[model samples]
Target: MIKYIGSKRALLPWITGTIQSIHHQVPIRTVVDLFSGSARVGHALKAKGFYVISNDLMTYAYILAQALVEADARTYSQERVQPILDRLQSLPPRQGWFTQDYCEKARYFQPKNGARIEAIREGLETEAGGDPLLRAILLTSLMLAADRVDSTTGIQMAYLKRWAPRAHNDLHLDYPPLLNGPGQALQGDALEVAAHLEADLFYLDPPYNQHSYLGNYHVWETLVRWDKPQTYGVANKRKDVQERKSPFNSKREAREAMQTLLGRIQAQHLVVSFNNEGFFAAEEIEEMLRHWGFVRRLTRPHARYVGARIGIYNPRGEKVGRVSHTENHEYLFVATHSRRVYNALSDHTEALQLSLF
Candidate 1:
């Protein structure tokens, strides 16, 4: 998977353990990930023998879920997919719109690698044909390849003024570590999905702050959509970034949206992850969830993302502001109607090995 802002990679053990503990008390066969950003949590749950239904509003996120969560590795094994990858890799790099926009205009990637990205992406449209899963796998490969060579602090909001050492390396695609299972991926609003999708457990990881994922990852959006959309600003963000706003991104509307979404979700159990920097406080979220059942909260302190640690930088790449704080609190809330489920989580809390505060 590509580098993501709230990937939940470090916290996977705790997330999975909580679900497994709940499963120990009551069977949880199916889990619905309402915001499967990188599909890391969904993929982990699937690997633990849970049928996962992963949904996200972003097309690239949907693709990640398709490749990692929905597509069964037994059906689309590395052996079966490598031949197509080989063909894509052998294609001669061609300079095109991707080169002009991302390379020449914004400098997200080097011109050389950007040309390869264009060629491979264009070739994927033909090679993957009509198979959506195959298309997702190819896109995943291309996206990961691009990520390795991107000259940024793990975001597309801006590129490094000077090329990072990794930017000089040749772009290479490797097969993603897909698991053997059956799952589903949907692209839509979370509230809408929660209204209809019923499952044993529902995981909510909504946008916590004003920073939009689409704005941070506009390049990936364009790469997967292949829309060649009109862009603006020094970052060359898709114009839609301004137009496509989520209620969760609004301080005024976030609370109401969360309340409505919490009311609509139809699940036996719910696990939610929220940042301390988010619009709502942890106590406020607990209060909202208590309407459903008993809620238990766990807190983990971790370092902030690299971009925040690097402080504020101008377009010239000079640091212009002091770093406020380099750490963050990620709060996980588990809510269920059953008292036994809550006890099971509380009992297993010690075993989670996450230094919860």
Candidate 2:
């Protein structure tokens, strides 16, 4: 499934390599995805038999972790879970704010069937908030279903300016599915999430922009939470905390935040994923590790789909432009724990002084 923002589809290759690099020295049984959006890294780790802990500040992401990554497939008796999705597909539309269906982010999906999505979302909340797995499954199905009915091409909601796509008539969840792993999903800050769980490796994919996740997919998540607060605009827009922001997303404070996060890390091997857009540079992460006394560093370069056709960041269609796609250009830094290496590395290295990682 295509996540709204900060997808890991492109980074799996690098992640796998990084994990394997540490595996030879020590078995990686536990994996923590600190800013677990879409739970892609956590899911991959789970599939590979690593215990996963998925954490995100957004409630929808927590639900995603419960439904798609952590739920034991066996816990689902077809009798219980099957009926939920079954009812979802057949449930008629309702007249709530979201029931009117407006293109959420992509300017995708005109309104006709988007209402069905709103109804399904509310229905699931009313029905399964207590049953984490069931609620998550139903919520995920709803998000996917909403995307199918929307008018945009990808997850961005700016709307397709040239020509809108047709909404799909038939969409349903595929259940009796296997979502097995030993994991827990927490909805909170990235740093706090780390304080609670320490795994063999911690994979951090935080919000690299100043924009909040709540503001980006507020409609979908609001419906998932089922509060349906005051909405605005030609399309239904949920009320959001305009000032709500992540430390990693801000321009002025991202550096200090990164510094705090790196220092507090308990995991032996750290793997951080970020493109050129984040507040800190690639060298900044490496320098942080080195200062913490890390020796070896491994960097990888790969192609990324920035904005040729996706990852739209602006409101007007005019804002679309080329994003950096360095051929074999992405970077992942891995460091091993060695007391000698730690002692050898300077508390004051000139290379570590640079803030551009």
lDDT of 2 by residue, 1-357 (tens): 544556767667557645754664567887778888777777777777778888888887887888767787667656667777887767786645554445343344555465566566667766675877777877776776665655554444345565444464544555624465456777788776666677778877767768666766665667567775666553345556454667877878888887788777788777777766666677776777686456444444444433344544454556555654534345555555755433333332223323223
TM-score of each: 0.98, 0.82
Candidate 1 displacement at residue 218 in angstroms: 0.5
Candidate 2: where are CA atoms >4 Å away?
A: 77-80, 101-107, 126-129, 166-168, 231-238, 295-328, 338-357
The numbered model that scores best in TM-score is: 1
Off by over 4 Å in 1: 354-357
TM-score of model 2 vs. true structure: 0.82
Distance from true location, Cα of 351 in model 1, Å: 3.2
lDDT of 1 by residue, 210-252 (tens): 9899999999999999998999999899999999999999999
Q: Model 1 — TM-score against the truth?
A: 0.98
Question: For every model in order, what is the number of clashing pairs?
Answer: 0, 22
